[model samples]
Target: MAREECKALLDALNKTTACYHHLVLTVGGSADTQDLREELQKTRQKARELAVATGARLTVALRDRGLATEERAEFERLWVAFSGCLDLLEADMQRSLTLGAAFPLHAPRRPLVRTGVAGGSSAVAARALSARSLRHEAEGDFDVADLPELEREVLQVGKMIDDMEMKVNVPRWTVQARQAAGAELLLSGASAGASSVGGISVQERAGPCDPSKALAATVFSAVLLVAVALALCVAKLS
Candidate 1:
């Protein structure tokens, strides 16, 4: 491929790969999760295979150019390292999946209001939901002691459990929010990847799934790509 074309393809693939890695976290229990896992397996294979193929083609090209023996060996070694990229990607995926599973509930409840509304059924529903949400706010039995006797009796259940869960909830909520946002970036990422060429993208080929993860995986992938691209640029300039 030409330079720009190759860059675009690589970017699209990277984004799609990141998307799947992020998705494995939030989609673990869904019916479609296995499909996501299968897609992930396929993606890792394609990446490894592509790296090998590219390395082979480049080696042949360099050999045809009458490159020095030592230089040729070095080039082959560098390209061979691409196969290990899959291993790194798989490790990141596993780590992110574990972090995602830390929540007590596998799935978050459907949010009360996607956008808090002020009128109609949404307004009434929002009010009702707000009341329910207040239940999460009370920190201890003391906070609920002011309620009716029957309400207080029911509230004691939280005393038994709240402190233990509260510790996890704080950090988990933050992680969950970021994963949701990152997943959004990844899903829409395919179109963003395609916007330049005005055609189908790598994400489309892989198919989309319900999404979320990879603070661990996402950051690593992004950093690695930037590092690799910079190395290539430096090599070309020299």
Candidate 2:
């Protein structure tokens, strides 16, 4: 369907939304662009409205799809890809809107004038002065109010699903450590068995690898290994 609103929205989104990495490394901080920030916020809000309307049409288009299992899967995949794009657009726009509303753009400075409070004639001027003073104070409040908290993730560059993971080196030291742990386990078991048959004193025969102690140690080692594996997985995914 042809839509000017959709076109405008897409254009605004495409222009305003840079790769997270681009924003951080290239665009720098949002501090220096007062006029640009206001314009972007207005553009973002317009795009969001258009997206909500157009997205409804997209949902219907999805429901209308009719295909074989393989083709249907492909169509669904495309839909999902488009949905991800939309989500990124919306999230970035919303992030800017929230921050912009809290700390508005700066206004141009106004000229100041001095007034006297000397007589009856001055009383009229004093009333006008008081009204102007209140207006100036309100403007000052707008400028000096607390700033909002920034979202660090907005600065994080978006990555393709394929870009999330990469091969990592398994250090030789890691292999050696695993081997050492295995050897320690084997020695403990051997000592336990030898003590069982050595005819040593009761307390001495119990040995370093008492059944419970050995089990606990093994379990702890296994847990540590699992924790390490999990940490590796998380690092890769992140």
Candidate 3:
């Protein structure tokens, strides 16, 4: 079971890393190209799918204890590879947004100024001013809108990976330390038949599952939902 899970995790990780690399390259080349909008949309969609799939596999691997030391080491290597790629992609995206590269910016339309009105001169000026103000406000909002939300989605995905890495590492190190201590105690002539160690009974050591697992799962689900919604919005905008 552990071997199978490890294989699945590696497969997902490989695909995700490949997708990330592709995204980084594509964005680098086409950030300012207006004609590549559809290609960028497709690339983003593929990347999102791979990211979500890889994250799910990673969560399962962390939950299962079937992975050996070497397998876990390989997993970490693959994770770091993709995580770095994600960071690069995010940085490129930020740069693109700042330069107004990826998304096209249209000039705000100038309000038409009416002249030679024979009546209500002050009232006409007030109404034109109000219209101009509203148009400016709407244009300002639209120009700055989508970039932040997209940036936030990237950050959220990074956070999810960081949290999962923490969850796996903490328990793994604790188990290794306990094993090392046990080995030392035996070498130093501690009783081989001791029923307990460090004031912890066998039953206590085998206690219930960690509560953080549920919380992490919930967080993962919410992030995935937000990602999907953001993808849809981007698709529509494109």
- On TM-score, who's better, 1 or 3? 3
Give a tens-digit lDDT track for model 1, residues 131-213: 43455444332212222332332233234234323422222222222145577789788778768555455567767654454
As a whole number from 0 to 100, the lDDT of residue 140 in candidate 2 is 63
Model 1 misplacement above 4 A: 1-13, 27-32, 61-87, 93-238
Show where candidate 3 strays beyond 4 Å.
1-33, 101-104, 109-149, 170-238
lDDT of each: 0.45, 0.46, 0.55
Task: For residues 1-238, write the lDDT of model 2, one tens digit per residue.
Answer: 3233444544544444444313322111443233344345355445445445544433443455363555444334433433455567646644553544444444446312212344568667667567656665565633223222223223222232122112212222322221445788899999998987676667576656568888999999999999999999999999
- Whole-structure CA lDDT of model 1: 0.45
TM-scores, one per candidate: 0.26, 0.31, 0.41
Least accurate 10 contiguous residues by lDDT in model 3: 28-37
As for lDDT, the candidate ahead, 2 or 3, is 3
Least well predicted 10-residue stretch by lDDT in candidate 2: 160-169
Model 1 TM-score is: 0.26
Model 2: colliding residue pairs: 20-157, 21-157
Considering TM-score, which of the candidate structures 1 and 2 is the better prediction for this target?
Answer: 2
